[model samples]
Structures are given as structure tokens and as C-alpha cells.
Target: MMKFFSPDMKCSALVILMINSFCVFSQIPHKFLYVVGCFENGTTEVQYEYDAEEMLYMDFDRDEVVYTVPTFLVDDPSKLFENLHIYLDAKKAKRSCKAIVVLCKEEEEDPTEESDPPESIIYPSEEVELGVENSLICFVNHFYPPEIKVTWTRNGLPVSEGASLSRYYPNNDQTFHQLSTLTFTPREGDIYSCTVEHMALDRPQTRIWEPDFSHDSSVGPDVYCGVGLAVGLLGVAAGTFLIVKGHHGR
Candidate 1:
């Protein structure tokens, strides 16, 4: 079913902007599902309607179809699954139905002395300083083969460009363990995550970071008092030595 379609090569920026406000209907349509845009807001204005001449997005407020997605056939199962996931996630978050989240699959790593797979790193996350831009991230991977692809993504979207990866092989073992490093910049309220998508797992495994949740900046005052006491004792010793030397001279 056509969720929406454009007509007469006319770009209606105003219509598109207006549709974005409805917040219930998805502008996305596919052959497998209706993928209707809806919310718990008690109105379903962005309903699906198909016309033979062209597919269109109708504005119930203006009583006219103003936009459309496209007309195409995509049969890949992975693509279909990704689409479904995006739609479901959008619905759950109450975000725009037109929002799309790209799905990523990790490449497997196999390493050997003669032929090392992609080097990968798996480590427990460290704590991120609050608002300091350093967030702790966790990753798990043992890439077996060489020339593996490594990427970091949040919410199934690419985060940054540069990533460093390494590999290690044991003396007796034949397979190599891979290591990968990516940025773990933490947001204030949101968590930073490291995901490993080895060819082994059907989906990537993600670990949420634990920031240092402590708000106390000062916790120790006894140590300061101890230092002050030591200084006082040293002063007393110096004064006694001076007094004894003066008395002996007299």
C-alpha cells in the first residue's frame, strides 16, 4: 500500500512542514505493512489513501493530499526487518513516523599467526565524568579473520568516523582475538554504549555505560586536620630547640 506520494513535480514545503506537526501518522509506507502514523492523542488524521494516478499524503486540515514517499519494490528480508524495527521504535518513542533508523551488522573477526582476523577489543566500561565529554563504554568481540569492518553507532546510527582496531594471537591457540576502540562520549542524560556486531551473533550486543553518579565534590576533611596537626608539632619542636640553645649560651 502507498503511504504517501508526491504529485505533478510540485514540492510543497509548507504542506510537508504542516504534516510534521500532526505527530501521529507516518509518512513512510511499504508493501508489507500499513505503517500508519498514529499517536495516543485520540486522532488518526494521517490515514492511508491510494490513488491510481499517484500516491499522495493528504492533510486532513486542508482536505488535500500534498506529499508522497515513492513507488518501488524492495524484496530483501533484511531491509524489511530494518523497516519494521524503525517503525516500531518510532511508535514507541512517539517520534515522527517518517523517522528512519539504519540497522548495522558487524563483521566477524578471525585471527591467526599467519593470518590474523580483525583485531577487536572487549572491555568493561569505565566511568564518565559528568559533562566532561568522557563517557565509559563497553565492547565485546573476538574477530577471527583479518580485514574486518569496525564502526560505532548509537540507536543504530553512525556516531563518528575514525576508529582504531588491534588484534592478538596466543602461542598455543590458533584463532586470534580482535580488539576495537571507538569514542564513548557520554551525554548528560543519555548513556553511551559500545556495540559489537561479530558475524557470529544475529544482532549486535550493546552495553550501557555507568557514569560516576556521585554529586559530592568534597568528602574528606579529617586528612586536612591531620596535616595541620603535624605542622603544629614541627613548630613546637623548632621553638624548644631554639630556647634550649639560648639558655646554654647564657
Candidate 2:
């Protein structure tokens, strides 16, 4: 079991992130089952994994356990009986996670440990086309403590209309990663930026993006002109050949 407290928090009742694992060797292929939970901002997320693949997760929005692999029982006979209790266990885990967060209160601010600032990048989901709707993705990864903030700006102005943030996902290195997305139509001369704020950094990290259709959009016209010039030269050559042949015959 591994436990991670909310980074960047000094309050008495802070966020709790926990991951628990179980191994089964009854079959030829060994299997690993794990549960991960994060309690924060009056919300809880609990996920179940089998052999490093997600099997189920608690949906806080719908207040139900959603199965990532729908045919869980059909896929694994060993899990047929365990499947019945998995949902109940997830619910229990969620309750216990919340209780721990409430009970584990920090009387004073704990000293900040060495933190890892997130590496961030911003890019469009698809090739940018002027006047076409697209999404801008800001990916942040390899940050410790799992508490970070991401914000977006367009041409130096703050934007929030079509922006969304994803829940923190654990990486193999025990760090975390997250994504923020913004939807908008690409236009000429439009610049976008994604900024990340974390405790590890003295200053926020920012990544900028702008539509560069100069190369992609210009290929069509350039090809057309080149082809047209080649065809015109070929026509002139053919006409000269016919005229020379007529003069020679006369």
C-alpha cells in the first residue's frame, strides 16, 4: 500500500490519495489487483485495476461503480465470485478514504518536502485550420504531490468558457499527470497559452501555442501552381514540335 497526501495543502483536513494492491498466483499467469482512491474538494474517486489495467472506477458524478471492462466476469472465471463484492468493496473504500481524510488533521503546517515541478506542453488536438473548431490540450506530467493548478489564456486574456481539467493520474515513478482542454475555433493570428502552478516552482510554468497554417495551408496552392506551370510548358513544347514538323514537310 502507498499513501500520498495532498501537496500544496496546509489545512487540517486535506486531500488523501491511496493505492492498495493484491496479488493472486492461483493460475499459471499471476495476476495483480489494485485499488486507488483520491479524496479532495468534497469529491471522491476510487478505481480498481487488475494486472495494471483498469477494471472499474467509482463515478462520483453518477454515484455508481462504472465497469471499465464490461465483460469482467466472462473474461476471468477466478473473479466471478469476487466480482459480486467488488462494487461493495469500492463503496466501502470510498467511505474509508473520506473518513481518513477527516480524521487525519494537521495541527501545524508540515514542512514542505522536495517537490517536482510539472513538465507541461500545449498543442492542438488536430491540425489547425482557420475557422474550424478544434480543441487545445495542455498536458502536465511528472509532478510530485499531485496538487496543481492549470489555467488557460488566449492572446494574454484569461479564458474559461470551454475549459476543463482532468483528475490526477499516477505515473509509474510515483509522480502524477493531468490534462486540461479548451475548445475553440482556430483563427488567424490567435495565440493561446497554458499555465501551470505548483508548489515546486517559484514561478508558474507557461507554454504557448499558435496556429501555424503557413506551411500546411500553403501546400495546396503551391502544388496547384507548380502543376499548372508544368502543363503550360508541355503545351508549348508540343506546339513547337508540330510547327517544326510542318515546316520540315513543306
Candidate 3:
């Protein structure tokens, strides 16, 4: 046989059960939708609804729905706003009509694992020309955690002016890439180095760039060859003139 409790006892028991459930639920990591609103009569109502378990956002007015979406993946966006009429009616009966809803999700760490030292390349801009103001870019790719320190040095002295580091961006494989640029006038024999420091490295990695000397090296040979060719043409012209003059004299 089942026993039925009095109305007052049943109400007390229900309240106690709700409180106990709230305590247990609060301990577990879960996403929630928090709603708060005020009515014209100056009464306020606050509600907390768990993600995937409840969809009571309709308790607030549409204008009051002003919260960031939860970070947790939504498996069913179609059902996100479903069953609103029931909650709206319940909220109306409770006299909590105007409200704002905000979705909150627990923060989770990034799933990508930490990686070894990042690969780096230091190069001047493609438009680099001699005696022109240009920038050198230090490209650091395939790194994890997105925490790195980039520094620049010119001719063994630290360069602080006109140096900037770009925001870390994610690569296709979930790794990160960052760029540091140094803007300066490229002078002859200037040695620039880009140094990268990260937790993955026992020592900082550095890449060096110097002005290309191939053009300068070829200039001497080119000038010598041109001068030799001109001298040979002059000798041939003199020989032809002598041959013409001798034939005329004969």
C-alpha cells in the first residue's frame, strides 16, 4: 500500500528535492543559460537553465534576450528554440515575463598538443631594393600554445623602433603561425637577425639575413668584359683602316 502525505508536507518535500538537485547539479561541469528580468511592477526574476537538459529561455521577453551564445557545440540548432510556448506560459503564471537570457559554457583547454621548437624563416620583403626603406619579416610557423617572444637585432645591437609582432594565427593543421616585422633602411653590410624564444626551446632560435652580394660581385666582371670587348673592336678597326690604306697606295 502507498502512503500519501499532507499538502503542506508534499510542498516542503518538493522544495527540499529541488534544492538538493541544484546543489548536485552545480558541482558538475555543465553549460547554463542564465535569465534575469524585471516586470513593470518592479519585481525581478532570475532563472538558471542547464544546457541540453532545459530550454527555458522564453521566460524572458525577446528584447531582453541579450547574452553571448554558449561555447559548447550545439548538436541541434533546430531544437534550440523549440518548446517555447510551454515555458512562456509557465513564466507568465509565475509573473516573471520580462527577462534577459545569457548562455554560459565552461571553458575547455585547447586540444592541440604542445609541439617542439617552431620552424622560422627570416627574409626581407620581395620589393627590397638597395638603399630603399623596406621591412624584413620573421615567419615562425607550425608552433603550439601561441606563446613566443620575437626580437630583432641589427649589427649586434637590439632594434626596438619600428618593430612589430603580428597576432598569432592558426594554421590548417591546428598549429600556429606568427610574424614579426622590422622596418628600416637597408644599408650596405647591414646584418639583421630575428630571434625567437619559446618554452619549447632550450635556447632561442635565430635566423640571420644580409644584403645579397651577387649583384655587386658580378658588376666587376661585367665592367671588365665590356672594356675588353671595346678594346678588341678598336684593334679590329685599326687593322681594317691599314688594309684599306695599303690597297689604295698599291
Candidate 4:
């Protein structure tokens, strides 16, 4: 029982089968790449859930597009957009459905404050004295590319002057580096802080230091805590003695 179909009919059946297969695969309409505008303090590229099915891409879409971004990522509370793809409807091949991964900026409540170590930075050992008598300058050094903007802030206010800044290439690390100096001044024992800012991030990385007038050299938290413990023990002993004397009198 060998019956041959007409050439026209055979061609029509093949075309229909191919259309059905396309609808099953590429036409399923699942999320591939997720794009986010900004993350926490120190993130270069916002990460998305790994999807083995589809290829991942940058902020931009399409099959082939590459972008260069700073190592550290964007800041918090940044205005962002969400993206996704939709496939052609199975029932209606002519119409393509748009599947939106709704702007979920507030969906899972975003995230808590990021608690990550800051970028690597080192200050020179030598301290530069400021003309403001008690003031001294400690610089923030950055060895990175893309030319990031540097700023000095005290108590969260923009600071100017009494700052030393420079950039150089010594063929040492084969990389460029920048140093931004800030004038740290405090009366007697007030705390002074140095903050380094990066354009790529929303918040600045900060380090705090307070001058100890009691010691000839600046004593930090460790030494101060020991002194506090000794004083606390003395107070407890004095209270115990007082309570004993009161009981004897009774």
C-alpha cells in the first residue's frame, strides 16, 4: 500500500511541522536576562539570577552587545528600569505577545543596607600638617581606570581647600592611580573622618580616626577600651564597700 502524496501537499505538511516546533521552543516566552539600574554601595554590575536556558547580556539587550563598566557598581535608590522578552503566541502565529517583568523595584523589598568591605585603599604613612594649627591631612589613594571623581567630606558636607590631589604612572603596577587629600581638624578630642567618594557608587567609603590628647601618640579604640574597663571595675568595688559599711551600721 504505497500511495504518494502530491508534491504541493508534501511541502505544505513540512511547513506546518516547522511552524509547530518554533511555537514550542522560542515561542514559550520565558524571562532570559534581567536588567537593573543600581545596586548597593559597591557593585559594578547588578547581578541577575542565572538562567541556563538563555544567554546573559549587559544592560542592553540583543544577542551581541558588550559594555564596559567600572568594577564597583552603582549606588542605592537609583532610578532604574526592568526588561524582559515575549514570544509569539502559539494559537496566533501572526501576533507576538509582550511579557513584561514588571518594574519590581519594590517587589521583594529590594535589599537591606549592603555590608561589604570597601575597595582597597592605602594612605601614606607620613602625615601632612595643615596650616589650621591642629589640622592634618590624610589622603585617599585610588589606583583604577575610567578616571573616577574624588571628593572630601567632613560631617557629610562638601569640603574644599586644604586638600592635596595628584595622579601618576610609574610603570610600577602598569596602572594609573589617584590621591585625594582632606584636611582633618578637630578641637582637643573631636573625631575626624576621611571619606573617599566614587562616581560609580552612591555612598562614600569612610574611615574614622580621633586624636587622643591624653597620650603623646594617637591611641585608638583598643587602648581606650582597656582604660574604660579599669575605671568600671574601680566604680563597682567602691559601691560594694559602701554597701558593706551601711549593713554594719544597721
Candidate 5:
């Protein structure tokens, strides 16, 4: 059964519904709602979702409720919490979680079903320019289980410094996504790659990224214009020489 902290924040309470409660096959679509949080470094994030879609979340830093889906509305989102005393309880929950108290447990997936593999891509944060400090972002999406390892490499050598991984984020389809970033100064002919390992895949997935410096794109038009001018001058000279030869023969 789904468990949550009691309203008083002193004990754990079981919610009415269990994860399997919605597992039955039915003609009608089932709507599932969940509220989860992460407490780290004295910070808290309480996210609420319905049908795997983000509805709203409480921003503890801002002490405000932020709406994610525009279609989901309420007269006053804050009013729902004004009298509930949830802010204090959420804080208490965070403390309890840091203390190793289990406020909630993750539901395991069915063993018979196959795991979904994730797809990944590597890209720069902005337009790539050699000799400039920049960051490379490796985005992995549409994976189940929310557990994965990401590693970075430069020129086939393992890279560790200046690399960071973000927390997994849920997608509308219930899958998860994550990002890893590496900071470095771009240099010509430098090759970079991000490799991902997940239980769903038979082997690790690797994506490569490199700076492009074969030629300057900005000089392309000028090069073509110069070539055309040189050809035109040669044609003009050939035509004048033929005219003079014809006149001498006359």
C-alpha cells in the first residue's frame, strides 16, 4: 500500500490505494496521482502529479506553489495548503527522511514485463567555438526504473572532474529522463563522449561529440565569390584575344 506521513508529521500512515490497485485491466482509463519529495542539503522538493503528468509542485526555496500544467487550475492553489499545515509537516518529513526513517517505499515493476531501454544524445550548451570554455550536456530519456550510471570520456580516456549528474525526472508516459554535464575548454580535434549504463540494456550506450573546425563557415561565400571573379576575368581575356586574332586575319 502507498504510505505517507501522518498529517501531524509524528507517524506514518497508509494511503487508501496501493500501487497494484490500479493494475487491473479495465475499459476505463485509470487516473493515478502521486506526491513525492527529495530532501538534500537542507532543501526540499515536493512534486505532485496526476496520470504521470506534472500538475504542480511546492517550491520550498520560494515558499510558493508553482503550477506546471496550464490546463489544471484552481481558484487558489495556495489556499489548498493554507489550512492543511502541510508546509510544517513536509519539513518534518524531510528531517525524518534524513534520519533514515522510511516515509515511502518504491514500487517494484512486474518481473514478466521487459524493461525499457533509454535513448541518449550529446550536445553543447551553446554554439561550439574552439578555445572557449563550454559545457557538454548528455541527455538520456524514456527509461524505466530511474536508475542509471553516466560516465564521460575525452579522447578515449575516462573523464571525471567537472562532470555532474542530475536527478531523474518523470515523463508523461511514466518513464524517466536524466542529464549529465561536463565543463571543459573546447580545443580543435578534441573528441568527447558520454556513456550510459542501465539494467534495461544489454550493453552500455555511448554517444560521441566533437568540435567542428574543418573550415570556417563564414568564409565560404567569400571563397565562392573570389572563384567566380577569377573565372570571369579569364573568360573576358579569352574573348578579347579571339576578337584581336579575328581582326588581324581580316
Candidate 6:
């Protein structure tokens, strides 16, 4: 006569004892039976189990041990252990390993196909002072599944030093984005590129950026202004020549 008690509940001792008694004689084989009662939107799980070592019925969950049967009531504990071993072997043969089940609100759908390739952009740091330490940023966005490989190169040679990649972040529409930056000093004619590889792309996507002295702010605006002045002078000279020739003919 095994006694069962709810370790957390004193008043539930009688209920646990009755349930354990029912479980002992229940025709359903313990090994094949799995009674899982879920509550609170599946956050709470209650599992009923049969313990072969103590030859007792038990119930437990994540928080605390719910109930256990006392040993005195179980007759022929050795026979119970034998039956449990046989049941375990049969279960292993049937499932081969653990099995999992997931419930979702939506209907189950097939696995997604490969998504579109990621969009990439490369740009130098805004501070354009020459001979200063700066970084080239590679922004890759709007990619699915979040797994990607980013690489950097300078002048067609692989650049590993001073290169870093940020963790993937989720986008508003459920896509993903990541950034890779390469730190380097700006120099004339240095070409840098960032390459991105993903499962959706047959070939790697690369974006290139280079420092151009012609586009330097200190010189670029002055050159454009000088060219505009020179054009204006030419136009004035042509107008004066035409007027003087008309006066001489008159």
C-alpha cells in the first residue's frame, strides 16, 4: 500500500493518493502512455510519469515536484522494472530517438524557398581629410535567413586587419541587416571593396569605393569656379569682337 503525496500541497494529498492508486491498476501500459496537460497558453506543462525504481506513479513539472507514490503499495517491484525495460527498448526501436511537436496559430507551410540577394552599399567616412585614419562602411540590408559572409579587400588583395562585422539585426518587415567596416587611412588611388556572399546569390555581391583627389572639397570647388570664369571671359571677348567688326563695317 504505497502512499502518494503532493509535495507542495498538503490538502491535495488525498487526491494524489487516489490518482496514484488509479494509475497503478490502469490497463494502459506506462511506457506507451504520455499524458501531458498544458495550461496558460502552453507555458505550463503537467506530465504524468510512472517511476520504475520506486515502482510508483509520479507527476512533475518545471517548477516543483507535484506528486509521488509511496513504495509499500507496489507489489512485485522487480516485475515492474522488467516490464519498463522492455517498454523502453520497444520505444527506442519505434522512434529511434527523441521526437518533438510544435503547435502554431497558423497552418503549417512548406519550407521557404531561397530569398532574394542582399543589397549592399560601400562608402567612405564623411570626414574626408587626407592622411587621417578613417573607415569604409559596408551596409548590407533586406536579406532573409540572416546568414551571410562579408569580406573586405584593398587593391584586389584580401584585407583582414582592422575589419569587423556587426551582429545581424532584424528589420521592420522581418528581413535582416548587417554592417561591416574596414578601418584604413585614406590615400590617393586606393581602391576598397566589400563583398557579400549568401545562399540566395549565385555569385558574390561586391561594392567598390575609391578616394579621388579631383573630388577633394578643397580643390574641387575652386577648379569648378575657375573653369566657369574662364568660360565667361571667352564669351565676353567674342561679344566685343562682333561689336567692333560691325562698327568698322559701318
lDDT of each: 0.32, 0.61, 0.51, 0.31, 0.58, 0.50
Model 5 scores a TM of 0.53
- Model 1 Cα lDDT, one tens digit per residue, 122-158: 3323333555544222222233322244456655566
What stretches of model 3 exceed 4 Å from their correct place? 1-113, 216-250
Cα lDDT of model 2 by residue, 127-241, tens digit: 6678999888787877766679999999999999999997666665545677788999998898999999998889999999888777676655654454454334333222100
CA error at residue 169 for candidate 1, angstroms:
4.5
Best by lDDT: 2
- The residue pairs found clashing in candidate 3 are none
Tens-place lDDT per residue, model 6, 59-96, is 23222232333447654444544544433433332232
Displacement of residue 114 (Cα, Å) in model 3 is 3.2
Ranking by TM-score: 2, 5, 6, 3, 4, 1
Mark the regions of model 1 whose C-alpha exceeds 4 Å error after superposition: 1-127, 135-143, 146-148, 167-172, 210-212, 215-250
Model 4 TM-score, all chains together: 0.30
Model 6 lDDT, residue 16, Cα: 13
lDDT of candidate 4 over 153-219, digit per residue (tens): 5555667777666532111221233445555554454444566655545676766655444533444
Q: lDDT at 162 for candidate 5?
A: 97
User: 1-250 in candidate 5: lDDT tens per residue?
Assistant: 1223333222211121212225447765655443434332334445544454555556666776676555466666666556866566556655555443233222212213334699987777755667889888887877754668999999999999999997566554445677788998989778999999998899999999888666677855654554454334333322110000011111
Sort every candidate by lDDT, greatest first: 2, 5, 3, 6, 1, 4
Candidate 6 ranges beyond 4 A from true positions: 1-109, 112-114, 215-250
Instruction: Show pairs that collide, candidate 6.
Output: 1-72, 1-73, 2-73
lDDT of 4 at 110: 31
Decide which is better by lDDT, 3 or 6.
Answer: 3
Candidate 2: residue pairs that collide: none
What would the TM-scores of all predictions be?
Answer: 0.30, 0.65, 0.42, 0.30, 0.53, 0.44
